[model samples]
Target: MGSRTILSSGTKTEQVFGYSRAVRAGDFIFVSGTTAMGPDGPVGEADIVAQSAECLRRIEEALAHFGAGLNTVVRTRVFVTDIDQWRRVGEAHSARFAEILPTTTIVGISALFDPRLLVEIEADAVLTTG
Candidate 1:
């Protein structure tokens, strides 16, 4: 087994929930379901597009902790509060992954931990080069 590295965003939720923001097991890194969680509250509140982008942004930040980037991603799972707004979320996803084209899935969910959160994204990445 490769060295295990745990990454933390140092958020209170992580401490309370007893989870790491991302975990690297060997060359594979798993980023937890991330949302637009801002210092004030859920960022972009009711805007799915903004929330979606923020979700990816947070995931990207987590990935960077392990010297990984979106291009290293192998798969992504998106959860949206409303399925009808999938196109808006897709735009954000495509903007980051147009070239890499990681396998992805988008699903509609009832609600998130916070009512203001509209989207959550989880990612799996493999370090290919270094």
Candidate 2:
């Protein structure tokens, strides 16, 4: 089986703890947990909704790097620092994958790597090829 790594410009392997943001093995693309951090830095200080959107955007970009897109996502996992923000976060997520409607799970966590980080997301997708 052939394998490949995907990384956006300025995105480091160490950022994801020594792992590539996304790895492609055959037709499957496995994306690691993606935070709101952008190429310059994190987005949205304490806005869970904005942060959630940013996280999904980054994940989508990672998937695209591997010839995949949000529509190809098969499953997803989301983590939020506060349970009360579920509605806001969920709304943001839904807007991103509304068409794909991939299987998803959301969990409330005590905290994340950074206090300002309100959400994190991970996904699995399949690239379509003829």
Candidate 3:
């Protein structure tokens, strides 16, 4: 078994909410739901595709801490405030994982922590040791 490690994004809410942005246990890495949050608030408030890209960027950053990348991702769960915006979010998601083509699930929700956040994405990856 490999050692466990917690990755942080240095956000105050992590301590407040008592959670790490991602955790690597053994050969698996699990990333928390990431959004388009910025220093002040959410970014790309009205653009679903932009928000989705930001979420993936945050997830990628988290994964990189453990020597993993989106190509290593095996699964992803995407949450959105509106299902109608799936097309935009899907496009953004594909742009990042077109070659990787990981398994995914997208669901609609009533709201998120911040009203401005339209998309949230989480991912799971396995270390590709060679």
Displacement of the residue 5 alpha carbon in candidate 1, Å: 0.4
lDDT (0-100) at residue 121 of candidate 1? 96
Give a tens-digit lDDT track for model 3, residues 1-130: 5899999887888989999999999999999999999987777767889889889988998988899889999999999999999988999999999999999999999999988889999999998655
Cα lDDT of model 1 by residue, 1-130, tens digit: 4899999889899999999999999999999999998989878878888888888988999999999899999999999888999999999999999999999999999999988899999999999755
Pick the winner on TM-score between candidates 2 and 3. 3
Q: What is the TM-score of each candidate against the true structure?
A: 0.94, 0.86, 0.94
- On residues 9-125, what C-alpha lDDT tens digit does candidate 2 reach at each position? 445545656667778887888888888875555697678888888888888888878777899998999998898888999899889888889899999999887677888999998
lDDT of each: 0.92, 0.82, 0.92
- Stretches of candidate 2 above 4 Å error? 6-16, 38-41
Those runs of model 1 whose alpha carbons end farther than 4 Å from true positions after fitting are none
- lDDT order of candidates, best first? 1, 3, 2
Give the poorly placed runs of model 3, Cα more than 4 Å off.
Answer: none
Alpha carbon lDDT at 70, candidate 3: 94
Q: Which 10-residue window of candidate 2 scores lowest in summed lDDT?
A: 7-16
